[model samples]
Target: MDKFLLQQQVLDRLAEDLLQVEQALREAHETATHEENIAENKYDTLGLEAAYLATGQARRAEAIRQAMAHWRQFRPRPYDASQGIQLGALVCLVDAGGQQQHLFLGPDGGSMRLLSGTQLVQVISSEAPLGRAMLGKYEGDGVLIGVGSIRQQFEVLQVD
Candidate 1:
């Protein structure tokens, strides 16, 4: 699998998301300027609530833009599993159920699974729980990641 291509695919997916988010932010911000957004009474907080929602949406859109910028500047290096997991490393793991997964340790993109030709690439941020557990791990190692009270076993097959 080509890591660089996978990276680009992830970025493309995030870029698509950014577009939708920006459009949503525009709609949210537009609400504040509309006359109907005005509160009916002092106790009615419709206008104030619209302003808050628009502000939050703007921040969210900005964050996604920053993540895209970060991804654009990143250069993926060849991985040596002995060095442990790091950003830009493509990792392969098998779960206790015998299911195999291909994961990319990325700097910012999270919860995005992309289909890169025949390979399925999952982009994860280092701050995420599963991403954190995968970091600093070598091939042939075992990891137990907990989702709530259940701990799932995973075997590190390789890192590319």
Candidate 2:
């Protein structure tokens, strides 16, 4: 894989997302304070619900904005093949059925499915269970992850 190409792709996607989120938040903030949104009766929850929804969206957008900033400022350094997985690492995991999945560890982009060419790249965080397990593990290493009642196994096939 071309690291430079992938980095640019991910960065572009995140930047676009940031713009859309900001615009939506701005529009919502404007409509949230219109006179029509004011409640006529104390028992009526329409205004309250509308206000809550706007506030919630604002908070969510704020979090994404902060994370997008981190992504923009992050400088991805080249890692040796032997090095453990960290930010900017593209990892390939193999399941029992020999199915392979590609995941890109990033500073911040949220959970997103991004397509570059014909491949789908999934953004993952170090806080995630599988992401945590991938740290410091070399090729041929196996890990078992359990979420709720399901247990899954994965083998580290490659890291680039």
Candidate 3:
């Protein structure tokens, strides 16, 4: 797949994930509010439990909102097809240990299932080691990634 197609795919996937998260957060918030209202008229034990659940739900809702805000400002440019590594490119690499991997620059979720044929590694942010190395790199570039105390070299075989 070319860079443009890959970029479009990533954007589409990200948008979909954002929508799902937003919906879930809305549902959770509504449920929590309902529970809290019901508990307000009940015993202290039930009210406490409801308050706890409501707090947890509120936290999750905030997190999802923050993530959605971040995604909204994320503008993925068209992939540079000139042989170098660029954002939105699907990269295939062989690690030093001889393991083959496919890395997709995307949000962290169950979206890995969308990558059916190859192994999918979700890069939630650009600061990660592998993610950092892949940025501004070209095909055939070799990068060393630190995993815990061990450092492994990965060769970029292809960029899609």
Candidate 4:
């Protein structure tokens, strides 16, 4: 799969999410400032509630903007066995059941799943549990992650 193209796809999806957030922010702001929403008494918190919603929406919009900036600057490099798995490595892992999963390790705030052709790829950050376990691991290496009380195991089938 083309990593560059996958990056573009991620950007496109983020752009859509940003647009929705911006629209929600605008509506929230309007509701907060509308004359009808103004509090008539201490118990009437419509205006205050709307203001809080607007603030949250504004913060969400800002976060999306920052995520976009980070993704724009990200570059996925070619995989090297000697270097082991790092950010931008496209990895395929197999579980004990023989089920395979594909992942594209990337920058933070871009943890999402997308379909690249017929294959589904999960984009993760190095900070994630599984991502941290895969770091510096080579092909045929074993990766173990604990979720609650259960421990899941996977083998590094391939890295590209």
lDDT of 1 by residue, 81-133 (tens): 56798888888999988899998888875568888687878788878887889
Q: Write the per-residue lDDT of candidate 4 for residues 1-160, one digit (tens) a residue.
A: 9999889988998899999989988998898899998888899888788889989998988988898898999988999889999999999999999999999999887889999999999999899999999999999999999989999999999999
Per-candidate TM-scores read 0.89, 0.86, 0.58, 0.97
Clashing pairs in 4: none
RMSD of each: 1.7, 2.0, 4.9, 0.9
TM-score of 1: 0.89
Ranking by lDDT: 4, 1, 2, 3
Q: What TM-score should be assigned to candidate 2?
A: 0.86
Candidate with best TM-score: 4
Candidate 2 stretches greater than 4 Å from native: none
lDDT of 1: 0.83
lDDT of each: 0.83, 0.75, 0.60, 0.93
Write the residue-wise lDDT of candidate 2 on 8-116 in tens digits. 6766776777677667767666666777867788876665676677787778777777877777776766766667767778888999999999988776555676776
Where does candidate 1 clash, by residue pair? none
Give the candidate order by descending TM-score. Answer: 4, 1, 2, 3
